[model samples]
Target: MENLNIGQHISRRYNEELEDIRNRVLAMGGLVEQQLKDAMTALEKRDAGLAAQVVERDCEVNAMEVAIDEECNRVLARRQPAASDLRLVVAVIKTITDLERIGDEAERIARMVSTLVREEHSTRLFTQIRNLGHHVSSMVHGALDAFAHLDTEKSVEVWSEDRLVDDEYDSLMRELMTYMMEDPRSIPSILQAMFAARAMERIGDRAGNICEYVIYLVKGKDVRHTRVDKSG
Candidate 1:
């Protein structure tokens, strides 16, 4: 039964590799979540020091994405996994791409924080932006939790939260426009606030993408373009 033993060994090794890749994806998710949180805090506190730290940490997130991608490629080349294993690799790749995009959005927000602080914008406007940041950050955290647990229900919930973020974004844009119209001198700072709001909205979108990937991984369904109805 020598051939049987060899087959078992190969199977175990392949399973182990899959688990390793899954762990790496979750670790990357944690980093992205922290990046978003730090960026939002920086904006709220108007702390350039914290914003700078968030920008620097983005490089680490980028490196993790590359490393995980390379490992996925290696598994595909060496193992030639099929069926469920193939789906897992594809999902991991998509999830990491979205995670990287989220990190990019976080960095954009941090840069805006730096500028807004230097410009000495009104504290009232920053307060509203902070509220928006909290909402988007919660979405990101929910998406990551869904992926880690392979909970499709939670994934759908996270996907639904994006609409709320969109509404908040639209409201913020209107407020900024009113500010600019009322006082031309505030245009520069209001413009920066608009950019920061856009970045936060994009981060919410990326989080929704991650949720879609999770649903795909668990259900073998593509829900990207279609409406997701949690209720039967």
Candidate 2:
């Protein structure tokens, strides 16, 4: 009887911890989304103030990641949960890492925006960069939504959007390359545009990682490197 009671108590505690972790992850996602939005806006408007704010606010995302990691560790040590509970804890750990990377990508975008603000460089590449940012931010938002809803199918759908981001990035690269080839003087701007495109591509990759974790939590399958049919 005592063991049964203890099991029930542990179960309750584990559930509470899971809920807390979910809330923390959601909050972290909110911060990352905001960072991406602010960075993109700063880039579009050439607002140095907004870019500076994004750099300053990145510390909050880093701090939340640490807190979430600590919480996951505490739960694992105390609860020693199995089945779905274990999956939840593991998924949260993976998801937070992706979120942190997304935060870093946002910071990189802001730094690039700072440069543009300082120099006021006018180029055709800005449209490509802005479109790439839009696609990446949309994927990030969808991935978080899939995580919140625990919809494996939606997560898979979100994962597929990474390809669109990649295609846009490739187009941006080709466009820049054409400019650099046409005019030797375009090298510096072309290089900067390439870096910004690469950053957005990485953000898309991280969003895809989050989608993979969500699918793993729901389907109990690893779909990281091997692409399986997610038509279901």
Candidate 3:
């Protein structure tokens, strides 16, 4: 039947569009992942040049977010996708927003690196901050991997790491406060380190947010504010 043929064509086209959106999201995720990695590398090496590059690349990340968002909107308007398709678009829109915030946090870290390069700071504190950066970077990568694979188990694993990140952040804050109190002259550098640590922790949170969106997409459940039962 001609009507049946036309239906098949439209269905195939819709699937193609969905796949295109997914690929674009993955591309955007890759860029954000690189931004976080480069920012940390620049911080560790005190490479101002690399930090500048990270900052410059953030504009590309921003543009990707805008482009993907527009495409999602267009798909919604044209296709009026139902059920799972609609959920996918909505989840991606939310995930992209979190990804953009993660990019912003990475940029903040890069700027902190620039300031830190000019200041004479404690080597031990910088080492700890670098360790935190490494942890958060791993979390980001895991989150993106989970999204790409639609693996709910991996998503939950990434989500569970957020508590560790928060604990490390608190411990670092206390240590930094002690340093500032003992030596007032170290306050400037310590303050920058504190800001960098906070940014790293926030990145972890954003990564968890992405994981939540992934779960939403796969399970059609809102787990953002609800407590996840790990016992099962």
Error of 2 at 156 (Å): 1.0
Q: What is the C-alpha RMSD of each candidate to the true structure, in Å?
A: 4.5, 4.1, 4.3
Q: Is candidate 1 or 2 superior in TM-score?
A: 1
Better of 2 and 3 by TM-score: 3
Off by over 4 Å in 3: 1-10, 230-232
| Candidate 2 collision pairs | none
- How far residue 19's Cα lies from its native spot in candidate 2, in Å, is 0.7
Question: lDDT per residue, candidate 1, 1-232, as tens digits?
Answer: 0111212335787777788898999999899989998888888888899999999999999999999999999999998876566777998999999999999999998888767776655566777788788998999999989988888899999999999999999999998999899988878888878888999999999999989987777777788899986542
Candidate 2 regions with alpha-carbon error over 4 angstroms: 1-11
Superposed Cα deviation of residue 183, candidate 1 (Å): 1.7
lDDT for model 1 comes to 0.85
Compose the digit string of candidate 3's lDDT tens values, residues 1-232. 0111212335788878888888899999999999999988888878889999999999999999999999999999998877677788998999999999999999998887777776766455677787788889999999999988888899999999999999989998998999999999889888888988999999999999999887877777789888755432
Indicate the residue-level lDDT of 218 in model 3: 75
* Segments in model 1 whose C-alpha atoms lie over 4 Å from true places: 1-10
lDDT, candidates in the order shown: 0.85, 0.83, 0.86
Of 1 and 2, the candidate ranking higher by lDDT: 1
Ten contiguous residues minimizing lDDT sum, candidate 3: 1-10
